[model samples]
Target: MLYKKECKISSEGFVIPDFDFDSADAVIPISTPSITQYEFDSFQLYLDLLDAMKHDKSSNFYPSILIKALKMFTASIISQKNNIPNELLESYDTPGTLLSLIDPNTDKTVFLEALHAAIAWTGAVKNNSAFSVPEFILFLIETSVYALSDPNFQYDRNIGNSTVALLRNILFHSNDAKFHFINNRGVELFSSLYLEVVGDTLKDYIIIVIINSLDVSPTPPFNFVKFVENPLLKSVFGYNLRSATSLEIRLALAYVKISPECALSFLNHIEIESSGIEFLFASTDTQVLLLELFEFLVTCSNETVVSIAEKKIQWNVFLPHIPMSFDSKLMKKTIQVAVNLFKIGHYKILDTLILKVLLEMMTIGNIKIKHRAMDAIRILINSGSPHSMDSIIGHNIISKICNFLESDRKDIFKFCFEMLLFIIQFALDGKCPRKVRDQLYEAEFEAIMEEVCGCELNEELANMADILKEKFDQLVAESETLEMAELENNHEIIEEEDYDDDEENEFHDNHFDNMNYYQQYAQNCMKGIEEEDESENESDDEEEDEWVDADEFPID
Candidate 1:
């Protein structure tokens, strides 16, 4: 294979003794053959290939020539020691025209081969400043889209993979390429292609395209809200959440950052199914994305949307899985979400569940998790309802805080102190139930406060401890006052009950005397009545005898 060779020549008409081909000043000697006859014939053949491809718009006249031209163009750009020739670089324009020949209904074997060539060519010239023209990049993207749009183009096939590779190369080359891709309905088209593609590889490529398209800083030019609204995009996101690879999950996460609206929409879809939360707890990458989306929703400051998210996402189902999450970063975000929920006051039912998780996390070795757990506890104690705050006081929460207060970790100590201070203040202010205050008292709450108050600490911890001690005293005073009030009330009730008992006993005695008097009087009356009855009976007996004698005489 004869080829053109260039040798550096000195200005003195003698070849440089040490000819450095890489030197900028090196030049080709006029005496040296820049092209042999064979090289000239090869160049001519390359030109003919380009011309043939240019005219073969339908690709009917030697379709292989398009593939040959694509390879030759890529190879020329890569192998050239100097600048790629204008003819070779300009040959990049022919692929798009040849791609137009591909029918969505036709077999795509040749069309895919041509696309692979274009991908190679684009990747080869990606770094070449001279070839990074808008026109060329759009042509590469359009050709890739056309090939990908083929209904018969099997993504698992070599052709479909090549087309995706080509598109990725073009889209990643520059922000402009990505912008043009999105502006030209590239997302819509790729989303459609993604649904039709079967293999993970093609799906991954599509995900990368969407990610790279929206990955620009300071606002990408794409319409992310509309992108998210697409059914295909939603399905892709849903699929990624459930079963896609980690890289795909990451790409979906990056895509979600494009817009708060997009994140909300994505989250809404994830919220539709428990499988989404299952995947979140199962995969570390997806969990990160879930947290980010959650943060976005919380910070967006739209209460209606946040409430909708709270309702749609089963926080009860998700809360129990926090302890099972092994990733500290993920656990931190989970705590953040819990804290935000507490701040929002929507998912109040999760307060106890979150409190338990936070307490459990406080015992973990991970400082971030522990810190976030404290933050969540502080938020709940500060802003949570009295009932919810009271719920945290149990399960040895006081003991946990006291133990954390004794830790060597300053963050833990500080956080624990702040939380304790909040709890004590909450108790003192009577925001918490009396039961909680008593529980704190039973947990050696005063001793813990005094221990913190006496320790030499940072200004913040010391100040917090002082406040906690003052509040603790006030809480104790109030509790004692309440106890005295209850005792006084009980004493008054006892005195009143004793008086009622004495009065009832006296009434019973008086009623008993009256009944006895009545019985005696009745007995005397009965004795007199018996005497009267005897007299009346004698008189009636005499009258009856007389009447009976008269009747007997009459009968006789």
Candidate 2:
């Protein structure tokens, strides 16, 4: 190396250091009475290093990306160990230097070394070292994803194991790291890779990575439905819940919200217990996450998952039991998940018990959750899930919807208007259950439509209102005929009962024949009674004739 420490003893007996020899680039050079530029030239090596990095990078980072990054990383790390910021010694581009190590083209051999270096440095720099930046974590994850995809790395299971292990530290420790990992598409790439590398070797880590992806819930979501559809993720997450570590099992609960299909894949190995429900559906801490997952899952349109969520796990049954805490953020999200479940055809989620919970939430005085609940009911009302509309009408929801229709809060007003509109259409269609529909007033709904027609409502509500008014008018026109039909039906029913009464009279008039049987039965009963009386009389006469003057002659 050009920079090294050496000393020579001259005849004068004082040690003089080599002019070119140096220990660190950031070190200050000796001062002279007249300072010259040449004596301190060595101090410029950091600039040279950066130039070299840029030069090598321009030349495809000569030899390899990992080597270039590691050298720069080593320099900064050495500087950082000497109570110096690596940026001061290694130039501010040191983190950028480490970034090259993760280029997807990195070969398997270099990648293995790179992963080890990444993992080691991750812990080494924990005391506020330069490598401890969030970008470093992102680098490791990006490298791991690339390495997992590299065909050269496929032969080496250790590469995957190391990459996944590194990810565990990065993902579990830092939310920012998790976010970067997800945004980097590490979830999907890792999900895709596990299918290749998993021979019972890396499923745990890969699944945990995808599971944590749901934690950050990265945008442009990993095609969870697409993965399940291909059986790619299905096979990757195919392992039993029993085979998973407690941590993996626990983190995987996030999947229920993200992809019920994948969660079902995990449960295929074991039956989900009540505890599973508690973790995913009942935990207030995870309510937001559960809600997020539900929000994503509904869009996937997997009926099997809906079936499991509704029937097997009984998500709806436990939902009402989960208290609507004053934490409106969670309550609002909870309402959203409930709406998602309703959308997925878990109709029982609209049961009065749960609706009561939602209604209470709407009235809880928290404007956000109130609006959220109102909007949620609006969604249910417009969901066209016969039960959604029925839910609005069946319980306290209709009143709340009507009252909120006049709310000064425009959002509530809009939501309630939409709800009332949908209910009117629902009632007009006669889709609602008789009892629930009975709770709905045609006139109240008609009046709402009339207002929508007359008011300066938005074009959409106005048009729908006009259409509904026409339908309502037609229904009203038919009501008189319908009532006449109903009267005739009742008349036919009354005549049928009178006909039955006449048949009864005819039977009474023909009762002589019936009375003959009765006479025989009565005569037989009287004859039997007379025989019993005569037998008792004869017994008494015999007892009297044989009687001694004793009062207890009956014993003889």
Candidate 3:
């Protein structure tokens, strides 16, 4: 029996000539041994050509011709009614050979064409039962990862696009392939290329690859966070016009969605020394994205997420952006994060500058922010540490709290009153500086409490106000008593100093007198010794005179 088949021209052909294998009149029998031999020989010829191209040291054969040959061979194998025999498939090793040809360092055009050929061959063989080998998938993954790992590799638009397409296709094949790719840290390698590449041509493809990989990854791998937290990605958080694209923001959002804790990782990666937040805020869209991310993190009840958020005490980078943010939702969420942080006892890290910002929020911020600001203040005051109280009082927070008492928002008024009560208690306990207590009294805080008492407040609020007034009165009296006692102690100290000074003067005078007496005694003793020596000299002279006279009288 003779069989005839027509071959459809593949769209993948570029410079390759089209053959009329589909000619209606050219019929070949399926059972013809000679035709089968011819098909095998043709396949072998292409395989031999591939081997030659692989070993070709020089540019003797153009990559275009080689790519066309690859495409034809792949098409032939795919178009055959029957599967390519296992022996032939193994002998050819077309996928492995095509993978080897993908040297990113080669000529850009050649590399791209070779990449396209390899991608096409992989796709063609993916449907072939005989070619469905796990080892082949591994080879594709390893090759793609290796190609992407070349730091010095540069890609033109075509090469970059096609290479990414190739990677994405391989990743889409099966979960096993995707798993292998991620396990090899392929996403990390490709993400690093974002910094290495000159333009945004490959950005979209890279993002898609990352998204797909993460989608297929089981239980969100740790590396997903690592990839998102990569410094290069964080570098984009700055106000660079090039990096403010919606796609990049989406990429960031995707990362955070993978794990809320990743948001903390992202925050950690932000270089505060650089104007990273400012740059991000410069773009309204980027600002919105960041605010959304922050809001998500704050709202997340995950312990790890909350813990990470709490550790970020440095709010300087976020300070400028918060007040300037036009998004009300974003602002509210940001204030909530602050509230949560303060509740966790991060008040010690809150500096004067941040406190001032919070004070502004309480006074002029929207109702939501003002409410949150009140909560934060209450937490700080309730900490009861002298330093915390000092930070509050140092910023003239007492005045800010007083202003809140006049607010129409009952919640604000109630919170303000409670905060005042706490502050007064702190003062009465002497945990605050005496100066702070004095300032509170000078601010006519008692008058504010009386005013609150006159308002139609709820019973709880009214009772709290009355109690606060009573406490204020007692605090003032106690403060006065403490002051009087301090004055008395000062007087006693002065009296003690005066008595000690007099005693010291008397001791010094007595010491001088003793020294003078000792000096006179020594001088008198020396004078006596001198007088004795003079007498002895006189005796000797008399004796010598007598001896001389005797000598004159007797020579014996």
Clashing pairs in 1: none
> Model 1, residue 394: what's the lDDT?
48
Q: On residues 45-78, what C-alpha lDDT tens digit does candidate 2 reach at each position? A: 5335544654464565454654544434433332
Per-prediction TM-score, please?
0.55, 0.45, 0.54
Top candidate, metric TM-score = 1
User: Which one wins by lDDT: 2 or 3?
Assistant: 3
Poorest stretch of ten by lDDT in candidate 2: 23-32
lDDT by residue (1-556, candidate 1, tens digit) is: 1123443223522111222312322221221223333443365466566655556567564556555554454344323424446665475554444344333333454454445445435544554332334555455455556545665645424544554565565556667766666666767667666676665555666766676677655565436325533665456455545654555555555665676666556666543456436655356666666556555554555555566655565555665666766668667777777776678774444443667777777786376677677767777666747656556664556766776666666687777767776676667676653665677767777777667666778888777777767776777778888889999999999999999999999999999999999999999999999999999999999998777445546543
Backbone clash count for every predicted candidate, in the order shown: 0, 2, 4
Error of 2 at 303 (Å): 6.9
Q: Candidate 2's C-alpha lDDT?
A: 0.52
- lDDT, candidate 1, residue 231? 64
Local accuracy by lDDT, each model? 0.59, 0.52, 0.60
Residue 415, model 2: lDDT of: 63
Q: After superposition, how far is residue 474 of candidate 1 from its true place, in Å?
A: 2.8
Candidate 3 residue spans exceeding 4 A from truth: 1-179, 182-188, 196-271, 275-314, 317-321, 352-355, 375-390, 447-460, 519-556
Q: What are the per-residue Cα lDDT tens digits for candidate 3 across 166-259?
A: 5655554556666665676666776776666554435555665665566565655776437755654666755453446655666666676666
